[model samples]
Target: MKKLVVTLALSLLGATAFAQPLSPEAKTRTLETLQQAIARRAFVPGVDFSKLPDALEKRRAELDKAEDMRAFSNTVNQVLRDFGISHIRLFTPAAAQQRRTGQAIGFGLGMAPAPDGLAVSTLAPGSHAAGVGLAIGDVITEVEGKPAGNNPTSVDQDGRETSLITVKRKADGAQKHVMLLRKPYSTIRKPTLTWPAPGVARFTLPSFTNGYSQPEVDALFAEVAKAKAKALIVDLRNNGGGLVNNSAHLLSLLLPPGTPTGCSVTRQMVAEYKEKTGKESSDPIEVAKWKGPDRKTTLRKLPPYQGKVVVLINRGSASASEIVSSVLREERKSLVIGQPSAGAVLTSIFAPLPTGFEVQLPLSDYITPKGVRLEKNPIKPDVEVANALPAKEEASDPCVLAALKALTK
Candidate 1:
């Protein structure tokens, strides 16, 4: 059985190394290594790793025909899908580099699923997409002359290359064409804080990873307190999860003392506990220690805003994002607005395969303070505000508007 909940503390740590294509012998070794790692480290229990060799043997014929890294990885990924769990994804060499550096060459645009096509869900102010008149709720109709939705997340623009993007504006059913230039991923939009209203402070957290440091958060909250903000709206839409510790620290500023955010269980600690005690104990004292004493509690006292704390989330919110949102809503009494979250709350670890690609597998399970497992059950918002595209101004974002309305009432 898979572990039902992710822990309160998550590492979300991944490692990568360089390697060339694998030889026939190396391919077999890599498969065996991956199988062993999954059996030993994955949070999914009741999987007999001893039978892994036979499983590999049966797939060897197909795997042996893979001459390149992509082919091999695709084969392994298909096999892993049998586990029927999220967070078990493989990255090719190029993808591994992109993941490690968080770099990609494309126009700064964040996309999400739309009814007709990939919609422009996120457009950083002054970004290429924004400068070209791309607005939220615009359905991308074509990319590079091909129909959109082929590669919604990526545009293979070579150095300084330009790609033509066509979108249909939801406002008046008008078609618009825009040229997007390829740029470094670092040039993407970053988190920003603003005073949308006299007493309302909104923090748009675009991502949870990258250089999103604690000091940055400290400075933001300091400003919030200085402004005497009466209402705080944490907009976490499209913020995929990053480090669990970072989210925990963010919660520390808002949550009361002794609040239990959640708990984690790793395969390594489980094995160690069984080896030492000759038995497994649920919430083993030893495993608890690995999570550290500081991680178990929230002690920081934030400003006495005493005002409405509204969180804005959507399907793009996931992992650590979900963790922080759930804790604030469940324990801190904050109002959650917008759609449900992505429900990707598992803790994954990335390791290098023989082919130099990286594979991220769920290494730990987590549970919320209320014993809710966020594996597949996303956090439903108290106020379900659907997407209202083609807003004339940023302030008109449906989620933000909903938060402000909730705060005033």
Candidate 2:
């Protein structure tokens, strides 16, 4: 019975195993996981990721073969926004590109939650925002048609008290409309890989939601194999983490055979144990754990890379990303770099409820191979690097530079 709980607990820990492309059907199922969890009160404040994308897919096939993918994806964006979860998001290739270059539409204004309205923290001078005389202190009361408070976590520019923001310009104030954005900037998606340092070999696995998760990861490994790279670098910089099976395959790629990636409880075990005494244990019962330890590779029977590795992390690197980084740091002769990671490395699994939905919950806690747990207190980098975000434009990245320096030694 203990085994079952243990297994259930490990389900979340194993999410960093691998990344695979999600089929339309699989995508739908994944979102269902969130909805069901909300229904069962497993993952609170959860919203369904299934509805938007599925609807768009159908619209493309029927409504307009000439449909603009960008527009369709925008719809998906708005839908995700409705959920109001900080981590609940969707990113696409076009959006990703736009974000990187910062060139789409607005004069350059970024929003944060203020006491009452949205905060205009980042402003690109001489852009549309500045041209129209929108000052940083100006509060944003509304965006399009929705209430800003749909996401209760928003603030205005003046730092005043406001919610359900629907701010209109003075001219439009009596018109019941707010002309918040005179110049609209383009939106972009997130980066798939975070290259820590120039000389380091490994890369961070930020999320499996990227369509190329499986293929790109395989290619990365293959590249490492071909290069015969010795010093590796994996940077889970601000990665929120995603999915279960993908995490498993990711770990499988690097771990020695039978390394016990994680343990979890599944239905079959639940049924078997329940049958034994017709009673279900309330507490977590240990179940089967993933044991993928040492093994020989097909290529010249070579062993997995046992060379030095350094993982770069921060408070944002949560869930599965933390697990992989922590495991390698614990078992191998590796170094952790940067500030402390998010430290969410417990085993979590998504439970599929009967109502076509699933709920993801943490099952059990895992100690490092050395038996040290990485929960609230994340792994501290052996050599801490100062926090640099939106990455400052220098000749190169300092974190990568640090990794290179470490590897050279």
Candidate 3:
């Protein structure tokens, strides 16, 4: 009888082993570190940082009063809203780690703004979502048992970080719940290339930073060159952007040598200029010399794709994605299709917090060659498709079909 009881107890213990929650100490540490990091690293270009002390102190008080990690996250996000800018955000621990290390959390699913709510638009093949019958047209109504309407993505209290998603499907108005393990999605790990139509090559560029290296970017273009594609379609529809250098590398393959990509204004450089010159000039031309030049010594040797290029963008396309699209539209003469981008073009650093979460604090602002700030003002597509999401089937993508027809014309 003692042996039987012992075995049952062991089983129970094993079952509950993955259910650890963050302790109060961990919560406190996380809040304190987040406060410090934001104060030290967060910058709003053209706004004085000294004027933010009162707000920061109030946010700190709110953090102290928070009862749990979710409350703490809510308070921190509320404070971030004061900046009134994009790109600065506090990511969940799982998401923070993903951005920091290029890992992914939850099933390989991508969401887009739908009329009803955020809809699942893309799914990684053979992914957990796919295995569990999660399909496109399913709107995510709740995540982790909360109404997910603009709610920050979160993990369960259990240590597994598994995401419990409540989905409402549009096909038959059916609702279902799914459990997805936190793992890297394969879409952004490599380029998705296909020939959607004759002589038109389509490459889905999910992210500039995720898993793809410089050699891989070169290899991608080399394959494009081999296809002898007369027209190219680059997909940035759901991409949330990535490394700036990688975007530049991709743009270099389409642009002529010595093309001016854009310019950036960092908080440190601004502070130094004020300290040294004691003058604050908001004029971009006054600081145009600081604009980084795209000097390519070998781009001339590579046969640039001298074809009509079309870029697809949506509300999820942001940061480095915006930069590339804006420059390509103005410089390389690429036609943009789809809705406006997310306009999160600022340069930011992902500073990890004590509780394993990370804060993306923007330290610089990027200005396009035409003197446009890519913060709240996104790059509008030449052919503006309505925000309505397409059906799950590939043939249903109106943007892709439109691009093909445009290329043929």
TM-score of every candidate: 0.78, 0.49, 0.79
Error of 3 at 49 (Å): 3.4
Clash counts for all predictions: 10, 70, 0
Task: Encode model 1's per-residue lDDT on 1-409: one tens digit a residue.
Answer: 2223332211111112222365787676777668766776666433333555666567777899877665677677777766655677667776566655665444666666666677876665544666788777788888778777644633432223566878899778999888876554432335678887897988877666665677778788888888888888988877777766678777776766677777665667667767876876555234545443324545655542455689888887888889889888878789888889878777777777665656676877666766666877888989998783324466777777777788888
**Candidate 2 runs further than 4 Å off:** 1-152, 155-199, 265-303, 346-360, 363-367, 388-395
Candidate 3 residue-wise lDDT, 1-409, digit = tens: 0110000000000001122245668776776676676678766566554544566577666766766554566577777777777766666665444554554544566665555555776666655676788776688877778876642233233335477878897678888888877554444456667788778888777667665577766777778888888988988876677766677778778887677787777766666666777877655434534544322313634666788899888877788778878888888788898888876777776666657676777777777776677787878888887642444555767888877777776
- Model 1 alpha-carbon miss at residue 40, Å: 2.9
1 against 2, candidate with superior TM-score: 1
**Strongest candidate by TM-score:** 3
Query: What is residue 181's positional error in candidate 1, in angstroms?
Result: 6.0
Candidate 2's error at 268, in angstroms? 9.6
Q: After superposition, how far is residue 345 of candidate 1 from its true place, in Å?
A: 1.1
Q: Is candidate 1 or candidate 3 better by lDDT?
A: 1
